[model samples]
Each structure stands twice: as C-alpha cells, then as structure tokens.
Target: MSGIYPFLTPAGDAARDARESAARELVRSTAAKAVESLELRLRVLGTLGPALAACAAAMATAFRAGGTLFAFGNGGSSTDAQAVAQVFRTPDRDGGRPWPALPAISLTGDAALLTALANDVAFDVVFARQLAALGRPGDVAMALSTSGGAVNVLRGLEQARRTGMVTVGFAGSGGGRMAEERLADHLFVVPSSSVHRVQEAQTTACHVLRELVRAEPAEA
Candidate 1:
C-alpha cells in the first residue's frame, strides 16, 4: 500500500511547488514595497508641513479675494475628486461651521455634462470644457491622476493655467508628464509605481488639504 498525502499535488509537483514559492516571495516583496511606500509618504508629510501652511495662507487669500475650488479626476480618482469637493462644500461637523461662501465643484460629478462634452467635443475636453466655463482667476483647479500623464488632466491643467486659476495636481509615479511639463502651480507626487498605493496616498493628501482648508479662518 502506498502512503497517502492529505493534499493532492499537480503532476509536476516539484516545479509547481517552486512556482508557488516564487509567487509567495513576489507577494511578500510587493507587500514590503507597499509598506515602504507608505513610510515614505509619512516622511514626505513632514517636509510638507511648511508648504502646506503656505498653501493654507494662499487659499485664505484667494478666498478673501473671492475665488472657488474646482477638482477633476478620472475613474477611481474621480471619486477622490468628489470627496475633496464635499470636504469643502459641507460644514465641518467638529467645528460646527460651514464654508458657505467658498464654492467647491467637482468636474467629474455631473454625468450629463460630462457625457455631452465627451460626445460633442472629445473625452479629453470634458474637464477642460468645464474649467473654461467655470474657472476664473484666484480660483484653484485641483487635478488628480495616478499616472500623472492623463491627456484630459493635462488639458484641464493647461486650461486652468491659461485662465489664471491656480493649478494643483496630485499624481504618482514621478509625476509623469505633469512633472515634465511643469504645468501645476503646486504638485503633490506620490512616490510609488503601484496604482493602489498611489491612490491611497492621493486620498490621504486630499484629506490633509481639506483639513488645512477647514482649519483656516473663515472669511469675515
């Protein structure tokens, strides 16, 4: 009688085992990279303190001078863009105060407008079209892209810049084309190649920016 193994193995047991082990090692390595990426983001946050303070000051100034905030993103990033807009539009529950005078719009929110723009013009014109219609000097355009090279995002940034709006880009992977083009007035780049990791950092950055804006003194 042959001894029975509890589990059945593939015909190429040794090769299968080796491949499985290699896969596990790869997973572990990727996990470690993700963790390191997060740690790097925390470290970068420390350096952002002074710059964020300056951004808050600048935002306050912009608001005082009567400006709005416009945000745009694609796919998952569109959700983040809307979330950021909500943070500005809604009242802060902890503070019990609302930023009533400050206008916050997400270019990705209106499905009808987006469809019309994409159909009538082009997909790349969606955000740019909205910016052209709504953006103004002293306003802020916050664009998010994990790859940092989305043509539509770049177009929106260009439109915002041309209209004199402050162009802010949140991106990943060395900031891609945006970094090359130097299109944004302020750019936050998440130093990770993994899409998941970059998106996580982008969400965190948006939350931080929202908090900074909320903490600022309301317009008198």
Candidate 2:
C-alpha cells in the first residue's frame, strides 16, 4: 500500500523500514481518533448552555453567601473534579483580579480521608461521608462521572442533597443514572460515545460555569 514515508525514507534503510511504516500507521490512526473526538465535543456544546448556566447560578450564590464548594468524581472524572475546583479557586481577570479566592475543595484531595472511608465504611460513601462532615446549606456539590451511573457517584449526590447543597453533574451520552434519577439539580450530559470527547466538553463547560459566576446576571 502507498504511504507518507515514500518520498523521504529514513537513512537507516531496510533495518528501519518496518518500524517507520508502523509508526506512520500509528500516527494516522491516532490522528483519525483525534478528529472524531473533536467532532463529538462540538456536538455536545449545544447541550451545555442551559445546564452550565444553571450550575453557575448555584455556584455564584454559594460564593456570595460565603459557602464552600465540594467537588468529587471517580477515576478520570476524579481528575476533572480537581481541575474544575482549581479553575474556580484560581480566577482570571483584569488588573490582577478583584474577586477573592473562592473556597473550593475536592473530595479526592484528601487521601487519608478517602482511604479511611473506603476502609472503614464503604467506597460508595466516601464522598457522602465527607459531605456529611464538611457541607452545609448554601454549599455547592459538583460531581463528574462519565457514565453518570456509578454507584458511588450516586451515593455522593444523594448525600449532597440531604445536606442541602446544590448538586451539579457532568455525564456522557444517555446521562446514565444521574438523569434517570434526577439526582443533580443541574445536570449536563454530553451526546457522545467517546469518553475523551465527553470530558473535553465537560472541561469547557466547567470553565464556562466559572465565567458565569463572574459575569453579571443578564438584565431581565
């Protein structure tokens, strides 16, 4: 078959021919996947407007009231939770910014606390336990779950609700149990199969949520 290496082959000659061909093929395959991932993210952007705005309102209310933000998720979603919290806590603005540092905490940030909950009680209650301890009315609870149906994620949301904190969720296609159960007050679901794309859109949605918090409410 024809290939991109034909015009200028590596100097190693036959010894590197097989390796070079394999590398070229890998690049092509990865590039195609990247294109698909970008497309999926674009498809989900439309669904985020309302959900993100609603979430922002909740977050802004928390900020205005001196309430803290508690964020959590499982696995890769865990990382997104951390990223979202950091983004909010670290704001951007003109003249070095005027808003005070928001108090945003990630449930996954405390290793000892998580291990203790997982060891003593149950993995499902890890986030629930923390919320029970640190959360109060007026706080915001943000959870990231690609599938949105993770048992642990559900438990966390349930606990957040009981604690009177606003619940926000970011999920992939179908919205999983998050949508089914209507656990989150503000739930955004990406209409895509690729986990990467869902997360990419989710990250953008998160930043937008922060922006809305800083933005003046629309005149109505």
Candidate 3:
C-alpha cells in the first residue's frame, strides 16, 4: 500500500505537511486583517458619537415632518444605498422597541429610469434629475461614495441642496471633493482608501444612525 500510494511516502507526506502549513498561515494572516479592519470600524464609530447623534436628529426631524428619504450611490455603494433604504423601510424588530417604517427610496432601484436618463441625457444627471423630479424641501438625501468624487453623487448632492433637502453623505478617502466643497449637511468620512473596509464602516454608521433616529421622540 505504501509503494502504490504517493501520500504514504515520506516525500509526499512532507509536501502535504508543507501545503497544510501554508494554508494555516494564509488563514491566520487573512483573519488577522479582518479583525484589524473590524476594530478600526468600531473605534472610528465611537469617535464619531456627537456627529452621528446630530445627523440622526436631523433625519428624525425630517421624518417627523413627513419628508421622504432618497438614497443613491454607484457600484458597491449603490448596493449600500439600497440597504440604507431597506433598513428604514423595514426596520429590524429584534430590539426593545420596534422602529417605525420610514419612507425611503433608492435612486438606483429603477433600472429603466436610470438607463433612460443615462442614455437620453448624461450619466452624471441620473440622480440629479430624479431628485429634481421627486425631492422636496425638508426631504432627506443620502449618498455614498468610496472616493467621494463620483460625479453623479456630487451632482445629486448639489440638486438636494438646491431643493432645500437635508443632504447626508457617507464618503471615504478623506471625503475627497464632497468634504472639500462642503456639500453634505452631515458628512461621515471613514478615512480609509480600501473600498471594502470603507463600505463596512459605512454600513455600521448607517445602522447606528437608524437607531439614533428611532430613539428620538416623535412629535405628538
């Protein structure tokens, strides 16, 4: 059996052991990176306590005034935008008191409209056009951008501001043009160049903002 099976030989066994050791090391290194990223997110979120609270209060006020929330983004951020809308539209009931389902719409959800605008006009105007059509004063506009320089995202924020909506921005890489121009009424920057880590931190921020908004007492 030893002669027929390569794994029964000493050389084969050594090779197998080397492969297993490499795999273990790879897993260890990857897991360590993930842990480091998670710690970064939690630490940053802790440091942003006051800003988060203020942003939440603003959002809660908008909701109380019957304002709708419009969330938009591109690529992975688009998915995050949808997640943001879903979180507000159907809040989690796992906690002490269930949150009310707030009105939220994802600008990236309508493929037909997005394509129509992109094809007919310009890609940069897709979100801006949507806001012009639907957004109102006192409404909330939330946008996410990893580099914070997406043209369409910037345009959307501009439109929101022009329409008197409360603009909220989730951005990474030192907030890029979004912070430079002071576009958002409330801007949360993750301070990371890595897209994955930035998105993860943004997701945490979104959940925290939702909780804080829900905690605010609604007007009688």
For model 3, how does the per-residue alpha-carbon lDDT over 1-220 read when each residue is reduced to its tens digit?
A: 4456544344667777866676688789999989978987998798887999999999999999999999999999999999999989995564666667999999999999999999999999999999999999999999999999999999999999999999999999899999999999999999789898999999999999998988888772
Query: Considering TM-score, which of the candidate structures 2 and 3 is the better prediction for this target?
Result: 3
lDDT of 2: 0.83
| Segments of candidate 3 deviating more than 4 angstroms | 1-15, 91-98
Worst 10 residues of 3 by lDDT: 1-10
TM-score head-to-head 1 vs 3, winner? 3
Candidate 2, 167: how far from true, in Å? 0.5
Q: List the residue pairs that clash in candidate 1.
A: none
Per-residue error for 116 in candidate 1, Å, reads 1.0
TM-score of predicted model 3? 0.90
Model 1, 12: alpha-carbon shift in Å?
22
TM-score of each candidate structure, all chains considered together:
0.79, 0.86, 0.90
Candidate 1 residue-wise lDDT, 1-220, digit = tens = 0135322334487866866776688789999987877786786577666666667667766777888999999998999899888877775465565545367899999999999999989999899989999999989999999999999999999999999988888888889999899999888888778787888877877777777866777664
Global Cα lDDT for candidate 1: 0.83
1-220: candidate 2 lDDT, tens digit per residue: 2366453445567637776777788899999988887776666666567767767777777777888988899998999899878977885564765655688999999899899999999998999989999999989999898898998889989999998998888889899999999999988888877788888888877877777787744222
Candidate 2, 155: how far from true, in Å?
A: 0.6
Model 2: weakest 10-residue lDDT segment is: 1-10
